[model samples]
Target: KQAMDFYDRALKLASTIPELQFPLMTYLGKGNALVRVGRVDEAKRVLDEALAVAEGDSAYGYEAELLLQLGLIADQQKDTARALALLARATNLAQKAGGNRIVAEIALETGRIQRQASRPSEAESTLRAGIDVARHMAERLLLPRLLGDLADLQVSNSRYAEARALLEEASDLLEGLLTNASSPWVRSRIIDSMDGIFLARVRLEGAQGQNASRLFAVLEQARGRAMSELVSARDSSNPAELRAGERKIAALQLKLLRTTDRSARQRLLDEIFRAEEELAPAATESFIRTRASRRKPVTLPELQRQLRADEVFLEFALAEPHSYALIATNHSARIHRLAGRADIRKTITA
Candidate 1:
């Protein structure tokens, strides 16, 4: 491939470029390109060099990314055990580095590998964790694929209703993304796959004596949207930007908690609130700059109104000394104190 050739040429000259920054990235790119072209041996050597460079750096995200690439190469070579081990290490490093997107991707791949290894339960658990991380991080690009994979797993398990929900959500998210900057044929391919899920949903809803026509109508409408929008609206604030805001808020909150002076605490609280407000929007406008004045914290009534009649929303907040779970139903609200990190993990695993 031309791309691979380009990378190969570039890599050959990279060692002579003394001014090159992040040489690890150059090796990483070249290794990935080599892997794509089936130059497995060369890719392994280059990737190993990248990994060595990454190991010497304080940034674990680079190390994690390199590990993931190496794991993929191993997977392609039919080295399942080694692939899984590499991916597991990548996942751990990604979590430590706050690389949520990479964590989701590795988890999704790990799930697929487990499924291939005939560990269905582990696959399901891993996929669910990936889906959760993707959703929480607003990772639209990874979320649809992760959801689709999980839905496929659900289909295999004969959990049709759950699968239907997952597919519909995935379709919706994919459709929204496609509308922004993608070819109509992309949506066409997505719809072709989703039509099967729609048919299954119709059958299930019919069996339950519920109206299924509305579902079909919604799907059709989504599919019928104009192919060309003639304009552009893009969200520049990606997960990384939101993450930056989150970190700032968290640091200020911690400082506020530890400060004994009322004025200092108030200032820290104000900064935290401002950061939170900037990230509060469920839907962001790409045309305009995001500002703290553009959003506000959701009030109890607003949150209550947002919940469906049969649905309960549980929001977790990890704070000093204790963690809290705020549970909200249609008309009631309550807070539950989490036992501890270990207990929470055990409860989640159970």
Candidate 2:
């Protein structure tokens, strides 16, 4: 909100200045700020205006970024087709502009949407391509999430060993992260990776009778605090700290866009990183608190204990080309292999 306020005030002043006309950049900044505050509708309107202004201008990276942001909004609204279209174009633009990070991110989203839409083949190919780009860029931060996402697909396909390998890689990447100055978003992804690792371990053990005791120990170490402590921890930041950090980040980003000097741009980037680092621990704590406030996740033992005398549970794990199910009755459990999703759907229909 403070960041939005700053941009709002700046635009009001900049609008009146004859020598400092930057309507497109200003609108984009404010739109981004609005997005941070969850004012998606308003952001769409402003970003649309920015898009109109960007056309016929040489804003290569900016144009791609705007499309990506708009695509995210569309995704949030569940407009799958529109989001995919926007993201596809954004991916092309980002790739052409050498924005590998953005390209990887866009690809990840594209693959995710494809998977959601039941286009597993396309999702697998897209995810592989994105992982390749991320590797080329050495995009350590996003790579773990990408790997985890792909591992999930692999799990569903019953590629248990492959999925476990990917999960281990992702978990390793996450383990290397410095938690002290990490964003809530990053921490959330880390937690998600941990979940993926656990799931893959279960699937592997079920399928191959491999003891995952070492893996579980490693996971426990990776997840520093106990789950109970994590659940009980309060938000670490006051409103003032959040507001100040957000404002500084926004200010630095806005300055980065306006400045043409290489040294100045570098300085602005550094400042933005610093600001984000300062906000990371607080954001992470808040996210954990909020997540814990919701329903606690069911443990493997808890799930097993929930089965009734007459009931059986079949936990299906699906990947691109194969599927596996862990079938459990009250007394016994076994792993069964099945054909891919299409075959399963056909069988169910029949």
Candidate 3:
């Protein structure tokens, strides 16, 4: 999982690359990567930046791809209405741009959202249609996830045999993909990408009273190949500080696209260079050093020693439909479930 900052060059983001080439895909791919790592808001903003670039270039193809990504994000957020609206627009743009591959991608996502909303028949039709298009277009990547999603629908309807066959076919395709992808980084991405297949299989096995641990081992086999490449950054990095710097870089990059004044553009270029130079180490490194950092883990007893008698340490996990907190004092610790995602969002919004 890459960050939004991974794809930026210091200043060479001149004009726009061909929609087929990268710096365009850079923005699009990085946005998708960020979403995979659960950085939802960051993904949205980066995609917005990508859209800005596409609009500047009048590259409607890139716009279609970017809109598809944004729609996927909206789907994750469970804003079905917004997701559908964006998908409809993306489908139109894709057709105009001759982006059949994107249309197939759109169908897969639209189907999943429909499934979530309990429109089973529509979802199945949409997914099956996507699979056909994907096959015709050689979109091997989309086919497995499409299969997995359709399998999920089948499972919901208690069509166990159909679901099992679909999952097995999806798994076989994924295995072939993994076998062909030789690069460690590429293999890691492939493993992450096919998570849906394993998930669907898990559901099928669970529904049929098969051993879930056996399914986990199979899934683990897939993930084990990429374990080294997938190590997360240490907890010491200050996300807020990093986000500020990256946002500045993004703002300057967008400004670089719009400004016609030569010297003003040069100044912006120089600033972006400096900011990128400063941000590079932290952004790329496995561990980043920060001000007054705690680089080493502390045991609970040791952590307790650092607290004042009147004070307690509280760690909260804010999740959808509910939240949780771990409260620890010098003597004791306890976990408490608090609010739903909506309630928490409302409070945060307020």
Q: Could you report the Cα RMSD, in angstroms, for every candidate shown?
A: 19.7, 11.3, 13.6
Q: So what's the TM-score on candidate 1?
A: 0.53
As for TM-score, the candidate ahead, 1 or 3, is 1
A best-first ranking of the candidates according to their lDDT comes to 3, 2, 1
All models: lDDT? Answer: 0.69, 0.71, 0.72
RMSD of 2: 11.3
**Deviation of model 3 at 212, angstroms:** 9.1
- The order of the candidates by TM-score, greatest first, is 2, 1, 3
Cα lDDT for residue 142, model 3?
A: 84
| lDDT at residue 159 of model 3 (Cα atoms) | 100
lDDT of 2 at 225: 39
**Mind giving the per-residue lDDT tens digits that candidate 3 earns over 286-340?**
2323212222323556656788889988755444334555566777655566685
**For this target, which candidate reaches the highest lDDT against the unseen true structure?**
3
lDDT at position 274, candidate 1: 79
By the lDDT metric, which is better: model 2 or model 3?
A: 3
Which scores better on lDDT, 1 or 2?
A: 2
Give the range where candidate 1 is weakest over 10 consecutive residues by summed lDDT: 287-296
Candidate 3 positional error at 12, Å: 9.9
